[model samples]
Target: MHITVEFGGGAELLFDNKKSHDVTLPEKDKEWIIKDLLIWIKDNLLKERPELFLQDESVRPGILVLINDADWELMDTVNYVIQENDRILFISTLHGG
Candidate 1:
């Protein structure tokens, strides 16, 4: 399935400073959850400093995630199942003054 991933608030820096990425997940029997997507991102898309983009299994604290422009927390957070063409955005809340 195809999905769009967006990064903002310095999150893009971890990904070649690009803000948007077009990603494809394999077609498999299991559903694709946000947690699994994170792993895929770390393995496939993350260009450098993975520690900045990942923590254990999910995004580190202070990073916000959105699904189809809605806060992912309202849609089951990391447990949310991803749909094709879904627009996912990651924004880091931490910034130096």
Candidate 2:
């Protein structure tokens, strides 16, 4: 499955400094969830401090996630089932301006 991942507000620093990435996860027995995707990103895409991006098995405090332009919090949050071609965005509010 293909997914679009976007980073902003300094979160890109952990992802090769790129603002967007088109990732393809191999088809498996089950659908991908936000929590599993987070682990995949941490293991594959993350290039810097893991703690800066994840905490408690989820996004760290002050980091915001949006799915298809809607806040993940309004969806199912970590349990939100990822869809093919979905657009997921992340922004770090913890960074100082």
Candidate 3:
């Protein structure tokens, strides 16, 4: 399946400073979920300081996840199933002062 993954609010720094990624997930025997996407990103996209982006297999606190413009919390967070053309956005609320 194909999707768009975006990072913002300094989160893109962890991904080589790029803000958007067009990803084509490999076909899996089971449906892909946000949890699986996180792993995929860690393996394929994340360039540094993973600890700042993820915690316990999920996005760390202060990060907001939106799926297709809706809050991921409303879509079951990491359990939300990925679909074709879905847009996933990760924005960090943590900013160094």
Candidate 4:
């Protein structure tokens, strides 16, 4: 199954490579999703920019995740059921001093 992941302040990434239909995700990745939504952020957002992983946080400062035009926060975050052709968007959250 192919899914499109959009990165906040970044570009859209496509993951067409699937090893299995019932592939269980890593425990660490699962935890990250619940706590800070890192897994979804990393999997979707960081493709060309591998340097982002080196940082302490999995989700960058400005990153905001949206699954199928709805914010992940409103949905199930990482546990959200990713269906075929589901559109995931990432955008930067505006912060003013």
- Which RMSD values do the candidates have, in order? 0.9, 0.8, 0.8, 7.8
Return the TM-score for each candidate structure.
0.95, 0.96, 0.97, 0.46
Cα-based RMSD of candidate 1? 0.9
Q: Which structure among the candidates has the greatest TM-score? A: 3
| For model 3, the run of ten residues with the poorest summed lDDT | 88-97
Local distance difference test, candidate 2: 0.94
Q: Could you give me the TM-score of model 1 versus the true structure? A: 0.95
Worst 10 residues of 1 by lDDT: 49-58
Clashes of 3: 0
Computed on alpha carbons, the lDDT of every model, listed in order, comes to 0.92, 0.94, 0.96, 0.47
| Candidate 3 TM-score, true structure as reference | 0.97
Best by lDDT: 3
Clashing pairs in 4: none
Q: Stretches of candidate 2 above 4 Å error?
A: none
Taking the tens digit of each residue's C-alpha lDDT, what string does model 4 give over 1-97?
Answer: 3455444443332123221122233344232233343454456434455443324543454557677788777876656666545666656554334
Clashes (backbone N, CA, C under 3 Å), per candidate, total 0, 0, 0, 0
Clashing pairs in 3: none
Tens digit of lDDT per residue, candidate 3, span 4-79? 9999999999999999999999998999999999999999999999999999999999999999999998999999
Please list the residue runs of candidate 1 whose C-alpha ends up more than 4 Å from where it truly belongs after superposition: none
lDDT of 2 by residue, 1-97 (tens): 9999999999999998999999998787988999999999998899999999999989999999999999999998999999989999999997886
Number of colliding residue pairs in model 2: 0
- Per-residue error at 46 for model 2, in Å? 0.3
